[model samples]
Target: MTAPAPAIPATGPTPRPPDTGARRKVGAGLLDPRQLLRALPGALRKLNPVTLARNPVMFVTEIGAALTTGLAVADPSVFGWLITGWLWLTVVFANLAEAVAESRGRAQADSLRRTRRQTTARRLTGWEPGAEPSAYLEQDVAAAELRRGDLVAVAAGELVPGDGDVIEGVAAVDESAITGESAPVIRESGGDRSAVTGGTRVLSDRVVVRITQEPGESFLDRMIALVEGAGRQKTPNELALNLLLVMMTFVFLVAVVTLQPMAVFSRDFMAAAHDTAALNADGVRGIVLVSLLVCLIPTTIGGLLSAIGIAGMDRLVQRNVLAMSGRAVEAAGDVNTLLLDKTGTITYGNRQAAGLLPVGGTDTRDLARAALLASLADETPEGRSIAAYTRREHGAGDGEPGRDVARPGMTWLPFTATTRMSGADLPGGLRLRKGAASAVAAWAVQNGGTVPAGFDYAVTEVSASGGTPLAVARQDGDGPAQVLGVVHLKDVVKPGLRERFGELRRMGIRTVMITGDNPVTAKAIAEEAGVDDFLAEATPEDKLALIRKEQAGGHLVAMTGDGTNDAPALAQADVGVAMNTGTSAAKEAGNMVDLDSDPTKIIEIVEIGKQLLITRGALTAFSIANDIAKYFAILPAMFGAVYPSLRAANVMGLHSPASAILSAVVFNAVIIVVLIPLALRGVRYRPSSADALLTRNLWIYGVGGLVLPFLAIKCIDVALVQFVPGI
Candidate 1:
């Protein structure tokens, strides 16, 4: 067997300059502390026991605050009250983190709402026939009141009233209001690209839109809900981590409770020597105990867990990839293999006609006649190109095929991507067929036809030159089908596909190009595009079997499709991204739709998914690690006052116990505010093998998480002692 094809060279994502030219409506001001301060009361409102009880980590702080407040009220020392007050703010800080995330989304929602004002929709009442033909008459109504299934007319410069499918006319739509891309998109009636959003504007011409969704249920509403964090739910991983933090909090509680008794026992044992370092029953202040528990738990991550998940979804929307669920987004990160087809995906979707070839010493005109008649009713670009090429080359008449040649009761076969062929039957018992070389040859032999002398040579020649060869055949009632000729279709591999396939390889994902084209054509395109594997002449069954086989090995698979035949395979894959310009069956079967209709967009979705998972993991690692330093800062200060020897755990060597606890509390609070940008933007991702990424992240986030907090806590301690009045 010949050696496998070498992989294509891959590279980075399509580079885009900062969106300053068409800036996003949301800005850095969303993170302003002054804004957070203004939203504090609302943030605090969410900290009610009923709401806080849902979070295992923050609930511990909430309970700690209640106990500490009682102790501070009873204690005579002003120092005790100061520490107690700051500890309560610690709980508020966590609430503030969640509130800030919600507030940012709300600001963007305001901007979205401004574009969604109540507009007058032109509802079609009926039409009147005149000398110019039927003219449509419409009545004006509020866009918001327009129910689903209502027909509305939108002229140029008017906003689309609701999410709907275009039923009439073609126009260029400006989607920049929602997508942030200034380029206008062309939406036409019939065939895909008909989904018009409510907030977008029709730049030119007019369209009659049949509303498919109700006003509040439109895509814009879903986007607003997404940004406002209304859809955020606790992921399984987050719930598991929260449970672990709760268990750890219990362990710390037992330790803090037992330490007081241990200290009293030490004093009893050292009574003869009169050791003043021994802790007594009262040596452990209740306020200090509350402080220690609040400090030790994973509050930073716990506070921002929902915010992180919400941010991940927001980032996806900004990229123009609409995810149906957060779970689906998470699943994208785990895909091991991607299944894509050649036409419209690896190659730019123009499959054009280069020329025609006649076989069996037949007249070229006869072959052209058969190819054109077989394809006249075929609407696919390939079929149209064949008919057009024949007309251009052989001077065929401009009459319709059914109206001119093959008359009544003739059955027409539509081209299926699975069968890779199409043909027509005549009531007079004549038949014309065209399809992939092998498929047509098989069909001919099944009907008792023998292969023509140069059939294989013709196919081999076209396939060798990277052209799709469709074999044409003709037959009568009881006679064998004879070969007529070949149709040469040429399509180019898209630019940047080489780099995208290469990037998937580096990211530890195997990309396989599956196509209905012949094996030779498949191999040629696969080699040029640089995919890891290629499946040629793949039937729908073959595509499905391939996915099941890979999944049997415990590998997660992602696939893209746009045809009715592709729906089952798409549903079978782990992450299915369908083209918005594809058939409705394809969109219904997949979990996501790419409005831009780019086939290689599967790579972008995978990257976004991976980035979301990595971002959450990194922040979680940091949140857990920072707790180690908090323990170091709080535990020693709590015990140091009674047992001077226990002060050794104070690695930072702060000014006093009061100042040390204050600094740790402040640091814990401030860190949540500090990470909001990262939560929204997500962590940076670099394409590499999984093992390499793991090692790199372990060192960067894991180790850095362990050490960064120590230094941060120490810096805050030094600064607070110099400037803050209480500390």
Candidate 2:
């Protein structure tokens, strides 16, 4: 009787840590009142002309404010003072938006710095020829003193000293300080998960780490610098938008400058035609012209542009994604095709032996024994599961599984991409192998074995059902090699992927699965996971070629990968998100790092990226629309008394020219403060088509921008008429 299939034996390189980090909810704190207050002084400091000049529109506004303040001081009218005060407030409010964003970044940097506090490392000085932990000589040293190639031994409860690879031993590491994860992850000496970040704590066991980077060059150091905003430069889109704003400011500047002559001419004409008092009207005043100029330019968007970019990066940090540059974040927004690696991304990664099926009436016991001997020395998850499956289904006989199975003097062969198989040369010149069905069949034929009639059918049956078929074969001394049977390795598709991919589909992104599995298995998994397409039996070169091909077709690609072999393709993709558990090479190659190591995080990143662009675009539309409304408020007021017919264009009747112009200036300044929360929090982005998003933003921000300012300025005018006496 069978021994109950034995629970499938716990297998794999290492047990993946539960992703507790992604589930942790973080509050949005960029708009906290305390943060706003803390940012106020920085805003005041930014009043320096040199600092303010970076934004052309805002710089022009400051110049206008300075001009009005001086004129107000010289004349001292109630109307002049109010306009000047509001003008100055406009510049200050603009500076405040940027200050708040940078302040949050600096605060995040401070938190990271606390985690990176210097710790003592037990640096290895020497290692003896043994494999035991006690064979090494170690010395205590500061973490900063550790350099590349230096070896350090870390024990339980101690923080990892520097970014490094585990060269020996295995342990559970808590990366909560960096990844915001509370669970401990297994970091072993071999495989892609060998990389460990500095400042994370070791939870259990001990590992000998080889530092990969010098001081101030580790991943955490880079992350700290990024969050500090010291390395932030405007993205290409931001630069292009700034150029557009500068041109718009220039156009408005020219319109404002020439308005003086027009005002003088209108004053002269009105005085000659009707009354002499028209010559002395406030319309010709330079301060009045300056107020109009300030309100006409696109100050609203110019003020919040930097804030939008900084907050976008800050949002990414909050989501446990560290983008190396603003460009990568922006590119993520435009990804047309997402090339996902099938193993870790689309599926649960590890393939396990589900069963063994014998062909051509072969005895099940004979096939089980051959499979066990072939997989005994294999370290892959499938190999270990196979041996465990055999021991439970068959029997250990006189010895334990994987221990003293047959005889001595055996030579082991490990799996490689080229060979596509792993096996051993047993005692008495018997060779046993287990690997890809095609690979083993070819080897058996090469070794003069007669092909089993039902071999092809068994392999196809397993593969068509989304199972990898590993064929077992044997060659006895001086005799023909014969096929034993096929081992079924089952792959499980990750949960909720179909729904997530459907969301991406709605967002106009195509999801492609790339894997080394056979075509049948690839098709089955791809359909089950709901990917748009699949490329089976792909090599590393095939992945790179596919990225290039997609780019050639004018598609922007985003891909996630963790293996060192995935580095080149990751580098080639437009947005490459490397898992934090990936190798250092893969991490360095990719543009962004997912601290939570969730492949589906690219979906959130795409949303954040799109939101960044949407926020800037929506605000820009509102700002321009705002300027259009201001033209109606201030233009007709400036020229109304000089030309009576101009009063007809003043849609909102005002008590005086003073009230109308001042109301426009006040509305302009107050609106910047009004939208500060929106600028920091960003506009809500749902996955939809480009045209749909455009139409919605146009109706909301664009149409609303035009209508709201008219009512707001009119109300401010009515309030001004109640109190002020100058008019």
Candidate 3:
């Protein structure tokens, strides 16, 4: 088997200068002092009952805290004051968890904002459509003044004023501000690489940009809003979990409310029987219903639920991906089928000119000149490679060795989907073209040129070897166009893809590669990349149909695309991750945007999503099991006075009833704060069978949760006896 090639950017390369900076780091530490300090104010503000009401569990805790505070003040006992203070602290700690998560995201947003400074745009005037002008009138204007459809000229070293498509010329753009990649990437007038972000800088040449976004509606604005938690909403799973918690809280509230009447009835019966030794009636009087209610509800999970959701989005942003909603991130965890583009996902995407094969009686040098001249004005990576190959093998004529300069009076013909060719119309009635073999052969036939012998062999050989063949041809005045040779463009499969696909397969995800390449080439590339399936000659309609078919079979489909034509299929997929550099239509249609524009980043997305789901699941198990142990610690203390034998239920023998009650509530509140870091960091994940994962969660969180709280509550009671007099 052929070894895979080293990976490059999905967008092809341009002429690069020396590196200016290293990759930008994403997100600060979860326990960063600065982030914690920033969160404190927000936490304090969230204490308002209106804001706390959004979380039913937390709201109930706050109400209980308020009731306890009133009772503590009226009765004025040491134990009452201690319990009231800890109850209020519990509400504050829950608010602090959510606040800390939001603060981390806010920090990321602030950093992004720094890169988007206001700049002036050289807006063009007197530029009529379809009119040929040597130059357009330039008007100095603020970038904010430029509206959609307005054209602006951005020169080298100038930041792109807004989100736009390149309408003319080609340039090397540095997108380090948003993508965190230091290498420069090419942005040309047409194709998938044409879309440029507002804050990226043009490092070389100039481009005529047609602004695509209005003020405050650019890609950067959307990204900032997402990272700052301004656009966060609960996912379907989160809503359902909250509903379950609310129901549990309601049941526990009723149970606690009925406990007081039962205590009164038990006391009356013992008094009538004159069994004074069996009952401590004073202990029944001391049972605090509010404390029992707070301890019983699922407070640990409720306190950290919002924090967990916020941290999930923050994790995606840290990975240089922006999700439009929490639902998209959650969906990524359950993606069963991943529909990937062949060019960038499996292969390096840069189809380079590897060789030249002459046809008929054409000389090697003659074919080289035609190919180089045809590619001189082409800015695509393949075009640049063709020109570079010609210059290196055959000497440059009257031009610099590394540079490509067009002759005077030459008209550059750019490649289009309809024409399927790019070339130059030279001086003195000479026309040169190079593109797909079929397109060039048809063009030659239309111009009265006969098909050259052995031309089919050359095209066949390139295609059979997983390479694209571009036929170079020329026409002079009224003379027929004759085919000269074939330019061999080979796209290499990316390295380590087989291994990555294997991992996905283990996780039960089916990988599919879709491309416009013919069957032989597609088959070879798919096998090389170890994908499960391949679809050759796939059009936008074909892609949409495939996604619909997968969904019909009850599969959750995920796909990555970066073109206007891909918008339909992207919108149809269960999880659509659009490249940040793609057209506005594609970006708007997808639910997530990959900042690095790496098609294979979806694999990483899947892992993050799984980690998020696993984290929530694990913490929930721990929270529910924790209540079991709290029951053992608090229940016996509440009723031991009513029945002497009930003291046996105090498995972790405590000094007194007051200490046990105080310890249980204290442990309940402190655990939320203790688990905040774990909630933010998320649970570690590995690709394994569902049964294995379920078994592991049961043992680690479920069993540990049931045991740890008993010891913690007992230790707290022992310490409370030493410090506090009443308890």
Q: Rate the local accuracy (lDDT) of all candidates.
A: 0.74, 0.83, 0.82
State TM-scores per candidate. Answer: 0.71, 0.79, 0.79
Candidate 3 lDDT at 28 equals 24
Q: What lDDT is obtained when candidate 3 is compared to the true structure?
A: 0.82
- How many clashes in each candidate? 2, 0, 0
Tens-digit lDDT track for model 3 on 493-552? 766778778877887899999999989999878888899999999999999999999999
Kindly indicate the candidate among 1 and 3 with the higher lDDT.
3
**Candidate 3: deviation at residue 399, Å?**
21
TM-score of 1: 0.71
Off by over 4 Å in 1: 1-45, 76-78, 120-159, 168-171, 202-208, 254-284, 351-459, 469-489, 535-552, 561-572, 580-589, 640-648, 654-656, 717-727
Candidate 1 at 666: error in angstroms? 3.3
Worst 10 residues of 3 by lDDT: 17-26
lDDT of 1 by residue, 123-142 (tens): 87563222121466678898
